[model samples]
Target chain A: MRFTSLSGLALGLALSSTAAFAGEIVLNSDQSDPAPKKAMEELIANFQAANPGITVKWNNFDHEGYKSAINNFLKANPPDVAAWYAGNRMAPQVKAGLFEDVTDVWEKNGLNDQLKSAAPSMTIDGKKWGVPYTYYQWGIYYRPDVFKANGVNVPKNWAELVAACAKLKAAGIAPFAIGSSQKWPTGGWFDYMDLRVNGYQFHMDLTGGKVAWTDPKVKAVFDKWAELVKPGYYIENAAALDWQDAIPQFASGKAAMYLMGNFAVAPMMKAGLKEDQLDFMQFPEITAGIPMAEDAPTDTFHIPSGAKNKDDAKKFLAFVASADAQTKLNATLGQLPVNSGSAKPDDKFLKAGFAMLSSAAGLAQFFDRDAPAEMASAGMDGFQEFMVHPDHQDAILARLEAVRAKAYK
Target chain B: MSAIAAQPDAPLAASWWKRNQLQLAPWLFLAPGIFAFAVYVMIPIVQSVSLSFYEWDGLTPDAKWVGFGNYTELWTDPDFWTSLRNNVAWLVMYLLAVPAGLAVALFLNQNVTGIRVYKSLFFFPFVISQVVVGLMFRWFYAPNFGLLSGVIKTLTGSNIAILADDRYATYGIIAAGLWPQIAYCMILYLTGLNNINSEQVEAARMDGARGWKLLWNIILPQLAPATFIAVVVTVIGALRSFDLVSIMTKGGPYGSTRVLSYYMYEKALSEYGFRMGYGAAIAVVLFLIMMVFITYFILQMLRQERDA
Candidate 1:
């Protein structure tokens, strides 16, 4: 017995020393934003400087590709830390027990207090699963010159916006430049229309599968959206193009407005459109008394369950949640920082977006991110079909209802 | 008889190893290839088939078996029907490549200076990735800016966004798909042309046969093998056309461009969540449809084998 006890003690010491000599942590992310990439590289450099023993090998992928690749990677060789979306989007992995619960870290690092509003989405049941790095608000991006040329002002209400679209159409300009070529872009339109028509609570309920898609309010929203499609007020080639591809039309003053997120600024700049030329506004109000809620989807980081370097991964997540990292990331990427003290951009549109987001009573994640991917996909397809043939509202609602039934089950 | 009996003393029985050598040798030679095929091809197909009968979000532990429910739902699903119809249309239209390819092959079969370069240039599309082809077609169909649209606008005084309009979206995609497929068929026929009987062509020429009549009577019969293979591959390509449609339109312009393969993917893996069972049902239907061609091909091959 005495000999066995000593042997166990010797083995434990050996294991501890071996763990202490562990190599670099692999950090996989889906952030392809140039500014964010540079800021993250700088942060990684700082992390390496602070911890001489530990290193980080970071890799990035496009958002859609990253989701599939990460799922595949986790099945075999999961990274130490990886970026993921929050809300119902993370529910599958969390339920699978693939993610490591960071509840203790949340309390210990005081991130729970710092991110009180965002914590609910990150927490599954009672444990925090991820740390949000940055988020952005979604709205309508319009070309001011086109609006001015058509003698149209930024409409604060639905009727005025419709009238403005008519004026633009009369002046031989596309009222909106939307690309249904990518299904997700069309989903943004559906979400905005739904939010304006039915209010935030109903939209949430509908996505959460607590309400049927055939509900009267949902039909009403689709009806209103159908009216926009009736006169072909949108760009003629909206069907077979990507959102980025549609930016040139807005930049060249061929079309006036684009319904998109703040990330659209990069593409607008790429098209040689100046900040003053491009501006934004909240989606026009549909319901008289309903409050405006911004679509603010956040990008977050999490540690997988079988991470190689748990301590190092935790340290990285905490660092990303820090004000310094948020400020740097926002400054570079034009993203709204999750951290309360992060600096705001000087651009008027960004400042307006920031003001609108900060003062808003409620915030919703983008439709696709907030809802389960299944519901969002089917819902978006229904929206596209409705847009193409507004007369098929009944048929579209029925199909969506069928999908929701299957999805919820 | 006595001499033969006496030989038993010389060797009563052969060794066990010697008796089984023929059987064992063949197994030993086949072991590596069989093991690899089982691991990669056979296993995944079986797994996908098994996954189709259950409703699991890929990550969940509990998978509910829905049996034929997925199939039943798919039958009534408009998107599924539309995709199925589109795939049929694709198959029928894609068959045009076999004849078109033969025509090109006949035209370019002769030896001429720089003719080889022209042939290779014609074959270029087949070597490029479908993603690149889709992107190229997208640019070519980009309304006013696109080359094809520009030419059409000049000729007809009207612009056409081939990819955008529902009436022409599927055909536009099919036309793009045909570009590479025709090239593939052309190469196959060119190789077939090399193997044709020179004596028969000489005899036909002596008999005053030329042009369409001469080619139809003599040349086509010789190229049967190449045509068979071309038809088989083209049919398969048309049926499995998900990549181009996905990259170009994503079954958009209101899902008008959706084919069975893309529809299956959308059902199983897209943001629409993993309706594995439903996707499997779609797969099973697609498999059944492909099986018709497969069965006919197998029968024809068997008949040829017997004849040979």
Candidate 2:
């Protein structure tokens, strides 16, 4: 098989010299940041330089537009390599056989040993499907200046956090800056609350359908969230704003804290806040003896089954998995590298965030990413409704149960 | 036959090409248009209808025929019912655009300074995309900082999150949708108004038919074609309203805004996993509902064609 494969490659090279190249191999991505786009262009330039016979073309769209366009593109001009989310988000596409399996490449490149923890999420059954580039943890971003002015410190536990919020409120500052209009922001609050109140195992069990949504452990998280909402700790008019738009309240000192992912840092800086002025802390402990966990959603790259250049795609994937590539990508994008031995920045906030996530015994993919999308849509809406009127817990639970039954089937 | 036989040796023989050219020329002219429409529109409609009976995620090689299982599921789904009810509300409320448009058209139809500028400005909303219109409305409905909320607060000391409240969310979005819809209707009416019979108006004036009677008796009948087109477009727009709902609320605040289109998208795509069969089922239901209105319109058009 090896001898035939080598000869076949040589024959193809000979034939290509006499014939015109087939066409351009297109690469599509949802990452719209200028830095990543430039890095990708550089990587493609390197690939084209190494492989002189093949040409590469590129198309990029933002997250929302990319989601809609992917299906259309798959049926029409499917790209060779595309960036997509992992876990249940990619399950449907994987099941449809839309992606190429690179298990052989995974072993050859030794990514299996390097990314042991990240490998399962990228695998369906026992087949490797994608190569991960970067992942980051989510936590509460707070103002150090507000904490200093109010004489409040970062809370280490659930009770201490409640007390800190009280102190902030007493000083006429909103304690939490949440925007529920986008619907998905409210989901992060639910996921963190569930993880802290129950445990990481329980969250997995509930999402995996082993435990029902109406279980008492899940109910307690909503109960606690309602308690927080009853008080005026969150910013006013949160229901009418997007998560990014809510940053103004924090920047202007109207709110003291925000629950967001690491991607939010760029927007915060764009809103005119310096890094020294802000900090991050994990969600406070809800269950006394339960181990700590953090939410880490990683972005990965996958090769479609229709790719004309499988060998080149594998080479690119192997190149992306290297420590140097991970570090360069994360440093340029302000995200944490998934590579274990990559060098990190010296900033206090990122260092503290790294320390917190490293110490965690488990990791929870964020709510929207963890649950199936159908369930998340209905589930997040229920969370928003419960936020407005906590007394409708029974009604909310019933509706979620109905949605879950249909979604899981 | 005798004429052909007599002309066999004459200069005026009827060739086969000449005899058939009249019949084939019309089809030749229509072939490209018909082929394009069949490929883009008719084929997709038929495929969606057939897929509605099957259970297959779009990626699977084979689809399982499940009869009316998709429709059966839709019948029991409360979200589907809610979306259908909202569609009914959108349809009824959207009709207000016809009269409202005519009123504006009449108001701006006068010969005054910069009247053309006023007309163009009034027609602006129709030209912008629905996504932009949704964003503008979202900003206007933002609770504390929105323009409408500010005005209401100054007058009534209360703030309403229009898009967040279940009761008002759909209505608020529909009103935003109506802004462009009304502009479109106004353009159609303005064109119709340009061609109204001036002789009839003058005769009505001699007969002392003025005010409401004069306008209703002499003008409105002539505007029937414009009104018919406006109502048809409005009904179709109301049914196909997925973008605004997806952008504004994503069928949220407790799934109160989950229209059938967004609901189908959530089921088939997104993180929901590929329930292609289920999504196709929802699409079939929506298509059937639209087909009812389309059939009625087609019948009406056929009657008008025969009369003409």
Q: Point to the candidate with the largest lDDT.
A: 1
Give the alpha carbon lDDT tens digit for every residue of A35-128 in model 2. Answer: 5676677666766665575577778888667875776576567788888877777776787788888898789978888777688788897998
- Model 2 chain B is weakest, by summed lDDT over 10 consecutive residues, at B8-17
The 10 consecutive residues of candidate 1 chain A with the worst lDDT sum are A67-76
The Cα error of candidate 1 at residue A51, in Å, is 3.8
Question: What is the overall TM-score of model 1 with all chains considered together?
Answer: 0.92
Candidate 2: the clashing residue pairs are A373-B271
lDDT at A98, model 1? 85
Each candidate structure's TM-score, on Cα atoms with residue i matched to residue i, is 0.92, 0.90
Model 2 alpha-carbon drift over 4 Å, by segment: A1-25, A34-56, B1-30, B269-273, B304-308
lDDT for every model?
Answer: 0.83, 0.82
DockQ of each two-chain model = 0.58, 0.48
Summarize candidate 1's per-residue lDDT along A1-409 as a digit string, tens digits: 9999999999998887665665688998876766667767877887777666678998888866776677666657889998888888788788888899988777887887777768877988888998988888788889887788778999999999999999999888898998777777888888888888888888889888888888888888878887788988888767767787788888899899899888888878889998678888988888898887767887888899878889888887887787777787677777778877667678676787888888764677777777777778777777777767788889888888887886765
- Give residue A214's lDDT in candidate 1 (0 to 100): 87
